[model samples]
Target chain A: DAGITQSPRHKVTETGTPVTLRCHQTENHRYMYWYRQDPGHGLRLIHYSYGVKDTDKGEVSDGYSVSRSKTEDFLLTLESATSSQTSVYFCAIRPQVYSGNTIYFGEGSWLTVV
Target chain B: DQQVKQNSPSLSVQEGRISILNCDYTNSMFDYFLWYKKYPAEGPTFLISISSIKDKNEDGRFTVFLNKSAKHLSLHIVPSQPGDSAVYFCAASSPGAGSYQLTFGKGTKLSVIP
Candidate 1:
């Protein structure tokens, strides 16, 4: 298994509140990604980082932000929580080596907005 | 519109039987395909992958077949076990598309009955 850890495995927040999910990896991977999984939607990328301080938005970047100051840490923040944002968020890392472009994922963070 | 589609929402198979999950993509630029397995309340794990240059790739009990001409891919699990019951997602990407992003399908739930 990849040495990826997501903080606050589960959380419940009220609407309009701020929420931040942290992803820490010990593998020293060059690329990191944040994705959300929902019923009927599967996993949608929110943001990803290619290197330290280099990040880009993904398909579902609305209302969410990400920052990566170090190679081992990637953070995803929900500026204002919404009911629609409730889903399981997963952090993934891709090794620099060619492993058929495979990305390993963390356990997951469950978030709920009421 | 969804670029990657898994038309079947769910499938069931008896233990020790073969389980097949299908996926299709509309984008012609996609050259890399992958399959992931996920259980309830957990992150998705990479299962298998196949490059466009190859038509098939296998690992142990899992085999991935890609048909570039049809823009379709399928995952086959031989002698499926109850523990193999989970949601399977198919993803595709184009290395030349700029970012290291993968478009995923809605996923198919596989139920392996005893």
Candidate 2:
């Protein structure tokens, strides 16, 4: 286990509401990522952090934002949730020790926007 | 445009048979490939990975084959068991800064039928 934990495993909210998902890791990895999984689109990167307070946009990052204030916590926020933004969000971490480009994922957060 | 593609949405294999999941990529810069297995309501777990320099990597009953020339990869599961049923995702990444971010293909759902 990578010791990754994601909060708000399931949620339903009205459109235009704000939602924040939290990902906490026990292993102090330097890299953390947020991704959304949709039926036909698979998993798309939303944002990633290489270190505390350092972040960058991924392939699909228009409506989402992320923050990594500490080594173990990464937060993803939907400024204004929309129906199209409904998806299963996943948090992943890459261990610095491993030479291979493999990242471990946490249990996903399921969000439904109506 | 999708950088990676998994054309097959679903596949079924009899128990003890071999299950092959194929993936193709459009980006030649992707040098590292990975496969992830995800069960319903859970996060995707890392399965196996291969570097661009190698054509194949194996772990027990699971093997991943890469064809750099064709920009394709396949995951082979030998003696498939019912427990192997899950969504398999193919992901790739290039080398350099931000290389930890992976581009994923739409997943292929695998069902190992008894």
Candidate 3:
């Protein structure tokens, strides 16, 4: 509840342009994730970071990349925007512990590739 | 294949009644299950969760039931109010104590009529 924030609440961009979405966490959690929500797909993970300078691909990592320079911030970048990538992007934080590991999501950023 | 599935796309219930939302999963390895509520323009908020070790977990007016044998779980909201109306998502993850990632259902839209 006290931990996550996403930038650019809403954005409209043309195709072929690059876009970057940012996620910031104050809890200093070790794990951060990026996900996209579509009409049929509830939420699909794009990429996640386990620690500073450590990141991994997820189920839907195509055309998306992520970086974590610091423990509190993660950035998801789209090299070339397309209509297919247009959706509500969400940033989440999950602790390393599995038993009590709960993931909290950001408010979400709506990106439209027109 | 999709491990998590929500058969119902939407449900409507009268205010002050029991609202039950169902979810099914194909994965047997999932031990941690969570339910989330999402309103318009907001991220999904954690509502309740039940572990595979337990058949049921309750908090306030919300209760979650997990049936390991059937690979099914349901969320019951007693005395539902208009404020309870929102899209409900069911998420599941493996029980291992490591970097955990969640798979979510398509979500069920619950409309509580006043």
Candidate 4:
């Protein structure tokens, strides 16, 4: 609840279609992260940004792209959605870039690709 | 290749009893760990965290124990209530350089039965 908001809280798209999820934060935290939560998969990091325009791929970065042109916004896009990509997406933020920093998350976006 | 692992997929505890969730990590380099809780349709919320420098940290009914030697961490929730039903994830991170990203476990779904 750290002033985070994820647009399109629910989205349903067909396979082969492009889908984008937006995460916005007012906390002005320097570290932002995009994660996907699937059954039996917990929460896997997909992409993260240390700063504006400074993004890095996570363990499950494949088939996904991220952009952070502004410090308050991070975007995750799937060029070609697949049924396997259906999952609840979460965006998290940390005030610092250290492991000890406390992280906050948005409400999340539920995406279903049929 | 999974640095953090939650071996238990689910757990059931009677209300007012204690609940324990376990997590393991394969990386000794991970200097810090965190526990997060999530209910369906909502994003994960930070529960408790402990650093490698400490063995235990407690907050209210939640306590986190970190055993660096075996690379294991556990979260204990006392007086579990029906509202405590949710999926809990154990996440780890190594401090240094430019990384605030956390590697999360698959998670354990805990149900507090009345």
Name the regions of candidate 3 deviating beyond 4 angstroms.
A96-99, B96-98
Instruction: List residue ranges in candidate 4 displaced over 4 A.
Output: A96-99
Native-to-model Cα distance after best TM-score fit, residue B91 in candidate 1, in Å? 0.6
lDDT of 4 by residue, B1-58 (tens): 7789999999999999999999999988888889989888788999988889999999
How many times do residue backbones clash in model 1? 0
Native contacts recovered, each model: 0.62, 0.84, 0.67, 0.67
Q: How does chain A of every candidate compare to the true chain A by TM-score? A: 0.97, 0.97, 0.94, 0.94
Q: Please tell me which predicted candidate would have the highest lDDT against the true structure.
A: 2
Ranking by DockQ: 2, 3, 1, 4
| CAPRI grade of model 2 | high
- In model 2, state the lDDT of residue B29: 92
Pick by DockQ: 1 or 2, better one: 2
lDDT of 3 at B20: 97
Residues A1-20, model 4: lDDT tens digits: 56889989999999999999
Model 4 scores what on Cα lDDT? 0.89
Q: TM-score chain B for all models.
A: 0.97, 0.98, 0.96, 0.97
Could you give the CAPRI-style class of model 3? medium
Candidate 2 backbone overlaps, count: 0
Model 4: TM-score for chain B: 0.97
> A32-65, model 3: which lDDT tens digit per residue?
8998989889988999888999999988999998
- What would the TM-score be for candidate 4 when compared with the true structure? 0.95
- Tell me model 2's lDDT, rounded to 2 decimals: 0.93
Worst 10-residue stretch by lDDT in candidate 1 chain B?
B94-103
